[model samples]
Target: MQLIESISKRHSPRSFDNKGIEQEKIELLIEAASWAPSAFNNQPWRFYVAEKNKNPEFYNNALNCLVDFNKSWAQTAPVLIITVVKTTYDHNNEANKFALHDLGLAIGNMMNQATVLNLFMHQMAGIKFDKFNKLLNLPQNMEPVSIIALGYLGKIEDLPAEIQKVENEKKRVRKPIEDILNYSPLK
Candidate 1:
């Protein structure tokens, strides 16, 4: 079975070259994200970008917000983005349960765009949200969810021996369709 080239080539790579991404490419990625479907067209996704070349202070601060493990590798990337979700709907001012899912869709679009641009992206859940929240002075309704490191692919040898070994050894895998796709709920 063949998949879309961008979709098939999209895999999280920890090693990243320090080359800076072009501003136009970044804008295009964000534009692609904006095109994603949102519940009620709320468009609740907000991105905080820190580019090593354009915003070194913000880049360093965003890097510090990552957990130690992620920071170790993510520091090599030239671009860092924090994906924030608006917890409330814009029109109704009510809690939105689909905001997180909407954010995921937006990120999916961004990831595909990155792949199309021949850039690599690694999304990490391990972030120090407290520090990030304080750094951004985020309001109660806006919650930081994930941080992404984006850049060109780097030499695997650049990573720590343990990570390099894991990177070399691991292959992308998925559960069988029977295990994942079900018409009925599990008992």
Candidate 2:
């Protein structure tokens, strides 16, 4: 698929089919994320992939870590990918401010790749921080940034009325380039 077309078609899929994604496809999606650019090449992103049927306990635990609102629709996705990043890059460094941005780029790459592969992805931020930290056994230095739900998309009828309306509209709107870009500031 063309890059622009793929990006335009990529939307958060709230309803997913129960069918499992092929292992090869999952690997390809991760491989796409692996190549994203990082600040000074300080690649700090880590991913934890959990499948529902294979590990119900872990899946439920992770799902429970999401906010109640997210849990409603997220349960439909067959796979959940937890994205994390280590804080310290070296022994002397106490901070790395760009880790989140780097992770975002990686995730964007992953989503686009999924669209190219005829898969759907939903990146979510509504998570219960405390529960997630404890359930995932995350080290103090590693920060869990986001959760990505992956699977094949279900029919439009499966979505809530509001969401179904938006999907059916098929309109993609974004801030105009002029509004986002600036050349010079008034003195």
Task: Give the top-scoring candidate (TM-score).
Answer: 1
How does each model score on lDDT?
0.92, 0.84
For candidate 2, write residues 1-187 as lDDT tens digits.
4559678888887889888889899999989999999877777798988899888888888889899767877888999988899787654567878888888888888988999888999888899988887876777888888788899987778776766675688665789989988899956
lDDT, candidate 1, equals 0.92
lDDT of 2: 0.84
Which prediction has the highest lDDT against the true structure?
1
> So what's the TM-score on candidate 1?
0.95
| Candidate 2 Cα misplacement greater than 4 A, ranges | 1-3, 159-172
Candidate 1 lDDT tens digits, 1-187: 8999999999999899988999999999999999999999999999999999999999999999999888888988999998999999999899999999999999999999999999988999998878877878789999988899999999899998877887899899999988978998889
Worst 10 residues of 2 by lDDT: 86-95
**Cα displacement (Å) at residue 110, model 1:** 0.7
Assess candidate 2 and give its TM-score to the true structure: 0.88
